[model samples]
Target chain A: MENFTFYNPTKIEFGTNKEQLIGQHLAQFGVKKVLLCYGSERIKQDGLFTTITSQLNEHGIEFIEFGGIVSNPVLSKVREAIKLIKATPVEAILSVGGGSVLDSAKAIAAGAKHEGDVWDLFIGKAQIKSALPIFAMMTLAATGSEMNTTAVVTNQETKEKLFIADESLFPKVSIVNPELMQSVPKDYLVYSAADIIAHSIEGYFTATDQPHLQSRIVEAIINTVIETTEVLLSDSTNYNARAEFAWASTLALNGLTTAGTAGFNFPNHMIEHSLSALFNVPHGAGLSIIIPAWMKWHHSHNTDQFKRFAKQVFAVKTAEEGIVALENWFNKIGTPTRLSQLNITQKDLPLITDNVLNNAKIFGIYHIYTKEVVNTILQDAL
Target chain B: MENFTFYNPTKIEFGTNKEQLIGQHLAQFGVKKVLLCYGSERIKQDGLFTTITSQLNEHGIEFIEFGGIVSNPVLSKVREAIKLIKATPVEAILSVGGGSVLDSAKAIAAGAKHEGDVWDLFIGKAQIKSALPIFAMMTLAATGSEMNTTAVVTNQETKEKLFIADESLFPKVSIVNPELMQSVPKDYLVYSAADIIAHSIEGYFTATDQPHLQSRIVEAIINTVIETTEVLLSDSTNYNARAEFAWASTLALNGLTTAGTAGFNFPNHMIEHSLSALFNVPHGAGLSIIIPAWMKWHHSHNTDQFKRFAKQVFAVKTAEEGIVALENWFNKIGTPTRLSQLNITQKDLPLITDNVLNNAKIFGIYHIYTKEVVNTILQDAL
Candidate 1:
């Protein structure tokens, strides 16, 4: 294990009816008013919006609404939402939806105090300092955004997607109710499971020198995801399955998996971001399609990691066979592994490669994944 | 899965030379002056004391020193430290040693504000409303006081050891460098490993339904400890082994293992506290002796949990066999599994049983471990 630092300060309140208690929790943070940012309608009709609003009223806390955040969370919309928040004098951003809206709310919190464009932060022009306190009542279990400092957003005009991590942007509190996940569509649940698996494996297989403890944590999370995903895909309304998935996914990438490991940059995420940016695919679908291809191409970078992954995750014999098992697992869950299957044209592959190279480079072992290498991976993926 | 809520708010600054970053990190918490609390002269001689003090001077922070805290930190010693801290007028408690000193420091932080005796909080007579900001440079791997809200203190006069837990006692920051743990003696290392395994298993075999994700997490941490401990026993200077052990032990009881599961009140802790109070044994040794005996006596009470523990941790076919395997594992690690091996008298057994049952009706299983149950487990241990 190489030297590293780990710090995640998000306070997670998990269980049934956690959202209803959010009002009192906000009181603990001393927020008098909030920007109630979410996607439109689903939450409101389900009575979550009213329940939370009533609770806030009970505490005499006010809120302004900013709904209709799209799946990709475009930059212009973020700017407009920031404008809306500023106009309302909201004290914090209280996001009440899936990853997209929470990601947008994070941007909005940072953007409200930012001097220049919010895109500057995404592009590494300015460091994140203080932000309006952000809180979340997470309805989805996919991104682990509720516990992590990562926020991914898209730029419409440039057709570019990127993520910015700022420690200051961690949610002051996250209310996770697994019951909320039951409202999600089956395909969405499957996609979320794929996303979590990708998150755990990236941290697992990329270690410069793998430690047994870290490997065990990675394997456990992966195994839990595998078991719970099967249960969830079969019955999305299974409360126990939802609860297990909700906790597993959150713990996977909330800085726990990457505690002391080195190497293995999030190459899959970089590639998936390219897919999501140009083709408008679901984030997890982009990952589900990219991971196996990237794994097949990159597995030899650390054969031992792949062997461990094969045995621990899929209970397979060899590293090569494990990759096949992963592919089979994804196919079983209806997450396509090919770019053509995700409806991306072969012409777009080179651009995806170029886009990843233009950004940050991943470290060690597979130390030579340049533009050509990335494109080769994309071609193999196609 | 049962309903539960989990939250850990401690910020862990981990890596090589993380102690040097402490002064800068503490400034963010608005702590200009700290009461530097630690055990013995080891930290001073080990160079951690000078390095931390120099860093504080570099950051323009002031501190007052208080040392000589012992194993199983006593309430009277804590009171003496409290008097010193009050006179110094520091805003925070900076603990620079193992869990004992940190636990004592937390008690001082919580008790300094109250009008009554600090022991009141220990005996459950008072609630900790607020605490001075606490920071730590961790030199120990067990107890997990770095990232939790619990402080266990022993009352030497009464031979009573108890703990106080409150949200306020959560450390503002904890700096964990695997290098710090390198200097720990081999016996202490094995004892801590046993303690970590006990912590992982204490909740692992709880009386809960569908604790899938949580059970996996418990196993992962325990398995990590078992593997890393072996490596450390053979090669103490191995960085990878130390890192794995450090991370696994911390995660063992940082509230992750109990998520959405019925909490098993720590029976090992209950039994061990008496041993620590009377004999001055290492905290982990007491736990190592008590945990397996408790498991054997209580296995029939919750066969499901025991069977799961068997399947996961020991890879045994039956719960009864798993109980035997656990006892053997303890012996293999050079930690005892019986009371008599520690030279604890038969007369002392009843007193320990009486103490444990005075608190929990059900010690660890689904059914209550009343006085009769406690006697049975203790008798089995002997």
Candidate 2:
């Protein structure tokens, strides 16, 4: 096992009606006021907004509402929120939607405290030293943003989707009421499943020092996601399945699966960020397109891990069969697995490859994921 | 899945030579002075003491030594340290040994801040609301005291082995350098393995609201412990095996395996604590003896979970086989698996049963673990 420091201090309130205690949770932290951030009007329509506000009032907490964050959360929206936060400073950021809103809230939190452009923190030009505390009432499960420190946001002007990770960005508390996720659209559910699997497999197959225990944990997560996703597809209201899926997603990228594993990169996320930035495809759909293709190309680089993944996760005999099994499962769940299904073709390969290469450079993986490698993987998707 | 709040704020520094940075870790918490706690003089003989003190000196930190803590760590020792701490207050308690020492350190940390008898915190008379900061450099992998809020200590006068769990008692930081554990005596290693497996199964079997995902995680931890223990027995110097075992032990009881599950109790620990309190048996050895006996007596109450455990961990078709398999494995590892092996006779059942019943009452499980039930389990052990 490789040396690693594991420290995630995010307190999670999980189960039904956990969001109702958001005000109490914040109050414990002495947060009297917060910038309430959300993606759309869906939460308001579903009565979640009123529920949260009533709880806030009950606890004598105040909030400034800042809605309209979107998936592939944009930098402009974050900057606007930061401006609002600076003008009427809130003690913390209360994200009331999915990963997108929470991601944006983290960016705004850091930007509110930062003296320079917040984008500088993402591009490695500046470090995040301090930020307003973050709390989340998660309406979705993908991205694992509720419990982790990293936040991904896209600069619409530059079309550069990037992330910043620092200890200061970890959420103080995250409420994951799986019941809140029952209303997620069917398409988004499959996409979330794919996204969670993507999170689990990146380090599992790519890590140079793959400890058996870490590998088992990753497999356990993937198995849970696969099982729960299938159950949710048939019965979205199955609370047990929804709870397990939500937790599996949170654990996928919450520093638990990747700890003690060395030399691993998020190639799937690296490539999918470009798709979200350029084509506006949902992150998980983009990953569903990229993962199998990348696996087909990269399996030879780590054949043993692939075979182990095959036997342990898919109960398949070979790496090829495992890849096929996963692809079939994605198809069964109605998640797009081909570039054509995503309306991208061979002609679009260059643009996607170039975007991915740019991200690889920023991610410090350009030496391995060069333009050639990017194009080849994209071609496999085609 | 059940409603739960999952909040573990302990920071873990895991890897080779992590102990060398203990002073820096303490400094990060602004601890200028610590009461260094340990078990025996063996650490001194092995250069661990010199290494730790030098690191403290390098970081300009001050410390006072408190050594000679024993396994089944006594409340008297903790009270002594607490008195010393009150007389010459320190910023934190730095535990430099295994679970026993760390458990004692946590009690000392709580006791130092309390005006009442420390035993009040263990029994139901008082609660621990605050404590001096605690840090640990672990040289053992059992009991999982490194990253948990709970601390177990035996009251010598009352012959009660009780534990206190509070958010305030969670270690500020824990350094888990598995290399430090490579020198563990073989018997202790086997005992530790038994203890880890015991920790994993307690929640796995007893939880009435068992989430499948949580079960999978428990299985993963158990499988890792079983695999790593076998490897370590053959090759104690195997770094990766030691690292995996240490990490698995930590994960077994660090609130991960039991999260989202409800209606669970640590009956194995409950029974084993009585043994430790009454006869001074090592915690793990007592557990190995009591586990199979308890399983034999209680499997029918949670038969489905037993069957699941049978298939998942032992690959057996029946719960009976699963219980036997675990017992055989314990025996194979040189840990005692029956009361007779522990030098106890059937005639001693009443005494052990009475002690366990007293504990069950304190644990609020007297209705389920009645005197008859405890006696029956003890009779089975014999």
Candidate 3:
């Protein structure tokens, strides 16, 4: 086991109607006003916006609406929200959608506090010393952004998808009402499943000193994600299934599964971020395409962990069978497993690789994930 | 899937030499002075005291010693510390030993702030609304006091080994350097193993609405505890085993395993606390004796979960076999699995039952854990 400081202070209110208490939670935190951030008008159509606004009014709190954040959230949208917040400052950021909105909220929170460009924080040119308190009413489960500090956002001009991590960026409270996620589109649901599995496996396979305890937790999260995903596919309204899937997604990247594991990096996420940045594919869709491809290429380097993952997660005999089982499961769940499925071909491999290389440099993994290595993995997807 | 607010805000610094940074951690919390709490003078003999004091001096933090806390920590010691703190107030309570010391520290932290008797907090006559900040450098793993809100302490006068749980009592920082635990006596190591497994199973079996995800996490913690305990028994100096065992112990009761599960109560701990309180048995020893007994008596109530536990943790076909396997493993690890092994006779059943009934009442499970039911479980232990 490696040395690690595990300190996620995000208070999660999980279950049905938890979003109704968002205003009370904010009030408890002493926030009189918040910048209500969301992805689309879907929350408004679903009555969630009214529900939250009514609660805020009940608590005598005020809010400013900031919508239009999209998946694979962009720096431009985050900057716009930051600008709005700067003009009419809110005490906190109330993220009312999925990971994208929450990630953008975190970015806006930091950017509103920072003097320089918000993109500077992502590129490591400026550190996030502090940010406005963040609270979330999650409408989706992927990205684990509700509980974690890191926020992944794409810089449109640079075409680079990067993340900024700081202890201060962790949300003060995150309301994860799985009921809110029942309305997620089928594609997005499976993509969330794939995304969660991606989060679990990255550190599991790559950690140099893979502690058995951490490995067991990763397997638990993956197994739960896989089972819950299958259950949700058949009956999206299954509250237990939805709850478990949402929780599994949150735990996947919430620092619990990766703690005490040494030298782990997000190679799959690194590559998928580039795909999402360049092709505008959904983040989880990009992950589903990249994971198997990367696994096929990288399995030899960590054969023991792959074999363990095979037995533990897939109940299969070998790493190769485990990879195949995962890809098959992804396909069964209606998530893309091939570049072709996303309408990308061998011709796109170079562009994807270059974009991935840029991410690799920013992630400080360029030494290992060079252009050649990335291209080979992308070709495997082809 | 339950409606629950999961909010553990304790920060854990886990790794080698983490305890050496205790002063810095205290200083980070703006604690200029602390009442350093510990058990025994062994830490002094081993130079841990010198190391801690030097760090305190270096950080310019004042400390007043309040040692002599013992295993199955008592309310008297906590009261003494509380009185000392009330007389000469400190910024925080710095616990420099294992769970007993930390549990005492939490009690002290609460007691110093409360106007009534400290035992009132335990018996639910009073609630802990606020507490002084707490810091801990744990030399032990069981009880998971390092990263949880609950603190278990025994009242010497009433012989009620009850716990007080409040979010306010959570330590500001906990330093878990597994290296510090290497010097633990062999008996204590096995006892810690039993305690961790006991923590995992209570919620796993007793929860009315057992979520598979939570069960998986509980199994993961149990599997890791079982595996690491065996490893540590053979090679106590093995850093990886110690680290995994320590981490597993922390995770067992840090609210992760029980989250999203419904209607779960700590019957094992409830009964074991009575045994420890009445007989002054070590917490884990009492647990080892009670767990199998409770399982035999209660398995029928949650047979499916028992079967799942059988297959998942013990790889057995029947809940009976799983119970037997766990008992045999407890015996194999040199922890007692029967009342006779603890030198308690069948005649003592009524006494233990009466004490347990007292706890059940306080725990609000008296309807289920009637005197007859408690006696039956105790009889099974005999």
TM per candidate comes to: 0.95, 0.99, 0.98
lDDT of 3 by residue, B126-222 (tens): 9898999989899988989888888989888888888888888888888999999999989999999999999999988988888888888889889
Model 2, B173-263: lDDT tens digits are 9999999998999999999999999999998988889888888888988999899999999999999999999999999999999899999
TM-score of chain B of each: 0.95, 0.99, 0.98
Q: What are the root-mean-square deviations of the candidates from the true structure over C-alphas?
A: 2.4, 1.1, 1.2
Interface RMSD of each: 1.7, 0.6, 0.6
CAPRI quality of model 3: high
lDDT of 1 at B79: 94
Error of 3 at A327 (Å): 1.1
The runs of at least 3 residues in candidate 1 whose Cα sits more than 4 Å from the true structure, single-residue gaps closed, are: A359-367, B359-367
Question: What DockQ does model 1 achieve?
Answer: 0.67
- TM-score-superior candidate, 1 or 3: 3
Predicted chain B of candidate 2, TM-score versus the true chain B: 0.99
Span of ten consecutive residues with least summed lDDT in model 3 chain B? B19-28
Considering only N, C-alpha and C atoms within 3 Å, which residue pairs clash in candidate 3? none
Least accurate 10 contiguous residues by lDDT in model 2 chain B: B339-348
Candidate 3's TM-score reads 0.98
For model 2, residues A1-382, the per-residue Cα lDDT tens digits are 9999999999999999888788888899998998999988988888999999999999989999999898999999998998888889999999988899999999999999999889999888999989999999999999999889999999989889999998988999999999999999999999999999999999999999999888889999999999999999899899999999999999999999998999999999999999999989999999999999999999999999999999999999899999999999999999999989888888888888888889998878999998888888998887
